[model samples]
Target: MSIDAFVIGIFFVTIHLLANELIPADRIKRLRWLSFSGGLAVSYVFVYVLPSLHREQHQLKDYASTFTMESELYFIGLLGLLLFYGIENSVSYAQAKGFAEYHAFFWLQVGFFAFYNMLIAYTVMASEIKGVQAVFYGAAIGLHFIAVAHDLWRKDPDRYRKVGRYVLASGIFVGWGIGTSLQLSSVMQSLIFAFISGAMILNVLKNELPKERDAHFPTFAFAIISYTSVTLALKYFFEW
Candidate 1:
């Protein structure tokens, strides 16, 4: 567990550095990789995370009696979706209304995503999911993080370069530190994973489905179909 946490934590921070500081955005775009990466992310969320979340709901059945554990956990995922949607769109609305001067929206984004990263870090570090499953999930998230770091930098290059980058990058490690040191109860852990799963859906789609962005459909399609197929095949073959 410690080794997994350490590897994920260190690798996440390293990717942020590459995405935010080391690489030029145009060259990054020219790589034409985000779509395929986004597809892998969406595939994992749909094919793996969502199922795990549902199973987790069952695990919490004994403790929560008011509502079906399934519904409650799904609600957590929905709440995550709405919260991030508001955070992202609110910033855009503020910027569009000539309110960029306030900079509050920008900072709000920072705070929300810092927490977002921490949530994911906590979930990944502490969850029982391991081996190939863990690798698939982690790879998808690593790609997703690059998109996020790139977006934050684009939003306010000066601020992100000056301070925001480091702040966001550190969030993963902070969450890992907390998660490793403390074990959350089963229900709480399940809820948190559901929330992160929801957030991942929103983050990946918002970046990939933008109308203004040029998309490589073939690459994207290939990623989704192939990864999904591989995951399915793995399940059937390994009976995992």
Candidate 2:
């Protein structure tokens, strides 16, 4: 494996493992940081993810054997969003019902995120993202993971600490292993990218853009502008 990919993989694993420490407990601090992270994630989605999806769509179209397959990748992206939304909705519903513990739902959510984490790590190595560009991509995603892990921790603190965190953390290496060992076709990798992009949009928006009382708009706006500018500079000027 390339050192850059390995390092980025470790970065994700570290973020997952130390998320409790990374995210503050104080409401205001947490909200502000989460807002900033949300902006970064959103910026990456617009600047990198969506464009990459479109590129993948074009690539897919070149190999289309059937009309349905031409645009099916975007549908897969929607499926990713829907899958995560269903998990989030179910968790909220269980909480509203005064359920003390979401035993089954907890595992289900963690399991899905584990797969999500795998996709994230896998793409880091398998995709065209490399060198400095991977650093930027990894940073945005690392912050996004912090927000997601923190949410899971809030949902089932005891169980998450005991088992959930480690399972999710392990997904990073598992994906890294797969990337290093198995060579997936370009079409398969493109589809994986599309799915993760959609899921990432939902995850970032849902957790970081909290209710009015919990959000910090100024911080969010600043982060969005700053990250977008930097990313564009890298892509256009430096050709990263």
Candidate 3:
């Protein structure tokens, strides 16, 4: 494997392993940082992910037999959003009803996100994105993972520490392995990218848009403006 890709793979794994510890345990401090990270993720999504879909849509046209239209990727994106939303809603409902601590729901979330992490890592390798672009991708997703990990940790601290984290970390490396060993078609990659974009949007907003008392809008807005400026500068001046 190339050194850059290998390093990126390791970086992703490290994020999963260390994410829970990285966020503050104090509620106010935790929510503030969550707001910051959520902004970073949202900025990256709007600046990079949506545009990526437009570019990849052109390539999707080549595989039109199955998709019929390049815009179908948007439909796929919607499905991605709904899938995570359904999971989140179900978990909430289960918790409300007091379903025996909701172990099943917890595992359902962990399992989905493990595969989600795998896909994130897979795209890192398979897309062959490097240099500044890779750094931003890693940073945004890494911070985003921190937010998600914090949520999972809150759900069942003991269980997450015992089992959930390792599963998610392993998924990163497994995806790296698959990506390095086998390259997928451009169309397939585009489809995955679309799905991830939608999923990412939901995850970030869900985490960020907490009850007004729990949110820190100023911190979130600062992060969004700062990260957005950096990305836009890179795209226009350095053409990253």
Candidate 4:
């Protein structure tokens, strides 16, 4: 595995642990949006801008070094954190104002964004693969979506609101299966996966958010497990 991949994987795992287990829930709500936004800015600088700068400096061979900055993975991670903060705050505000249904879609939107960006990050990291590797990758992604679906199923009543998420998950699973069967190029597979994942997250955030807080811990656990499982699965699949 490339240094970039290794670093990214580690960063994901660390953050997942921190956000899910280490960080106190009370403090999480108090987290500032600026902190997340600053992280996003740093991520953009490292993942997107740094590589280009390094390439210009004729240090293209150190691409892995540039890529391993945790920016790519953390971009969406911080975004999800921000969204979570936003939803919680919005919900609290709405409740204070007696607008229960006003920001009900906030939670749903957060879930969708998290799932979607996670898929994109996964695809971005998935640069090469063979048969079993592809299957494992697909399965890992499918499982994450399944987690999201389970969360949705347990929460909302609006059937129509959940439809898009389900469709997005199913589409990616099917696309991944087909891509694996046909032995598609890494770039093609990644692009297709990224597109679907981005679309799902974007649409869900734009549409609605979820309300219930009972599933927060489970959702956090699922995300951490998903990240770890996918990394281990990918490593094994590649026989690395």
Candidate 5:
């Protein structure tokens, strides 16, 4: 299990780096590929993450002194959703204004996503499921990350190519290094998964559901329908 995680971590980093370089510039192509990515991500959250979080509440009783709730993780997930939505809007506002006074805000986006990457990398590496299950997750996440990287590049080309990609790419290795060494309790793991699940929802939808900017509706719909069907099949029948 440990070796699998470490190896998968390396593969995750490679794919993230490749996403910055390899994804194409066509609108249709982007949507066709990313729709599946977004659907898979969202499906994982609904079918796996939500149920796991609900089942993990007992692990968080030690946190009762801090708060009391059967669904605190869900609450945390909501915060994660709001946080990214706010940042996404703020960054868009700054970019529309020519990013003059607010170039620092672009860096803020980088900083926020660096932590996001680290969180995701840590989660992927720390997962109890190894082999193909972990690889499936990491690759699906890599495709979603490609959308995020595109958004960043679209917002600021020079900076993303020069700096932002490097930051997020580095986060994977850093997170993996940290995760492999840490022995977090179940509560900590639950909180991390909750936050990622929420962030994934916001990030994928924001990019995928936009109808403007030549969004490919046909491809998007197909990807969503196909990927969701496959994911549900695996969950219910194959027991994956």
Candidate 6:
């Protein structure tokens, strides 16, 4: 995708998120859903479909053919897993909170991350150097997992959900270490982390978030941002 298009997409997504999270109204929920759907549909049509149409008109192959089908399928699966967990968590939260208030905001976050990863993957595909692409992709996945882990850690430490989070983090780092040594496909490495993290997050948000005695937004945000920044910096400087 063009940088301009990507920036515009992010802007729309940011607006959707801010609206859903900060606004309070019955219509806000419906508006947020419509906005999210519209954003994703527009992005897919412009970035994926319109290009294919142009390719057909010019009798040229699809430019995105450079992206492996396996990778794309893996990303689709990742999206499905995330959506499943998101819906599941939303239901749980709705039951506890007596409304579907945060569901839109939750989905906004998911859409934002999905769009962010799509851009990152597009950038990786555009780069000709395989080594640099691998490092970049790996670093992105690593930072994502680190954020997931830190989010869990900021919740009540003694909560049973914390155990699941730790297990998920263990699986991620173990998979990362193995993928690093074996030079596994970036898509597969990302899936390994995605599944584990999604499962853990779903479990915690469902079973623990409602009853947690020590949940703090500041701590969660701090941990996620701090770890992500450190991971990104290390990936850039250490090439690991």
Lowest lDDT sum, 10 consecutive residues, model 1, at 207-216
lDDT of 1: 0.79
Write the candidate numbers in order of decreasing lDDT. 2, 3, 1, 5, 4, 6
Each model's RMSD to truth, in Å? 2.2, 1.8, 1.8, 12.7, 2.8, 15.2
lDDT values for all models? 0.79, 0.83, 0.81, 0.41, 0.73, 0.38
lDDT of 4 by residue, 14-112 (tens): 332233234333344422322332223223333333343333334323456644552443343445446555654564566577766744554555444
Kindly provide the TM-score of model 1 when superposed on the true structure, using C-alpha atoms.
0.89
- Per-residue lDDT tens digits for candidate 2, residues 1-240, read 788888888899988887887665544376787678777888888888888888888877667664346567789899999999999888788777877666787788999999999998888877646778888888888888888888888888888889999999999889988887788988789889889888987887777666677669998899999999999998898776
TM-score for predicted model 4 compared with the true structure? 0.37
Per-model TM against the reference: 0.89, 0.93, 0.93, 0.37, 0.85, 0.29
Q: Extract clashing residue pairs from model 6.
A: none
* Deviation from truth (RMSD, Å), model 4: 12.7
What is the per-residue lDDT of model 3 for residues 58-121, given as tens digits with 9 covering 90 to 100? 7766676877765877888888999999998888888889898588998999999998888888
Measured by lDDT, the strongest candidate is 2
Our model 3 lands, by Cα RMSD against the true structure, at: 1.8
lDDT of 3: 0.81
Off by over 4 Å in 2: 66-70
- Which parts of model 1 have CA positions greater than 4 angstroms off? 21-23, 29-31, 64-69, 100-102, 210-213, 238-240
TM-score order, best first, reads 2, 3, 1, 5, 4, 6
lDDT of 2 at 68: 44
- Regions of model 3 farther than 4 Å from truth: none
lDDT of 5 at 133: 68
Between 2 and 3, whose lDDT is larger? 2
Error of 2 at 205 (Å): 2.0
